[model samples]
Target: MLDSGAVAEPFEREWFMRHPMRVAHDLVGAMLVVDRNGDQVVARIVEVEAYGGMEDLASHATMYRVGRETIGSAPGVLYMQRSYGLHTMTNIVAHE
Candidate 1:
């Protein structure tokens, strides 16, 4: 059971519109919420990695240019891709 007053305010799009490094840093200690079948699950974000476009050699954008539409789009959008053709990697798009 949860109290209505215990709920935290949601992060806005502007909250994720900063530099990837900054966003990653700020994401620490944040809470991630998942609602499934009327059940809500909450998890704390402990760490995050920032990936800049073009310049970041490790960034998927370097190899997958087609993803720019979502990765370079507005903030708060989910950027997902398959890694090593096995695991699905999910990320939040940061600043342009």
Candidate 2:
């Protein structure tokens, strides 16, 4: 059992090597940790959407050249793109 205020161990890279659908489902409630310039930021992952490459028609990989490159690249690469010309959406390449 974990004590209150204790943070869980970070997930390993292998955790993301699984199929995207599994990754998305498992990510719910996980904590996202960001360390920048010695400052740490942590947030709870509340939602996620999985996009299967090539086989998924709704995936951005099917519609954009950038998406294809990003998805095809190695895992952990951040695929950052503008959403609907407004919000910036960030995704991580998975299943490499």
Which candidate has the highest lDDT of all?
Answer: 2
Query: lDDT tens digits, residues 1-96, model 1?
Result: 335577688889998888888988988887878799999888777767888876788877777865655666788777668877898766788884
**Any idea what lDDT model 2 has?**
0.79
What is the per-residue lDDT of model 2 for residues 1-96, given as tens digits with 9 covering 90 to 100?
224587588767777788888888988887767899999877777778899898899998899888987787766566678878998766877783
lDDT scores in order: 0.78, 0.79
lDDT of 1 at 51: 88
Q: What's the lDDT for residue 81 in model 2?
A: 86
Model 1 CA deviation exceeding 4 Å by range:
1-5
Taking all chains together, each candidate's TM-score versus the true structure is 0.74, 0.80
- Cα error, residue 54 of model 1, in Å, equals 2.7
Q: Give residue 87's lDDT in candidate 1 (0 to 100).
A: 87
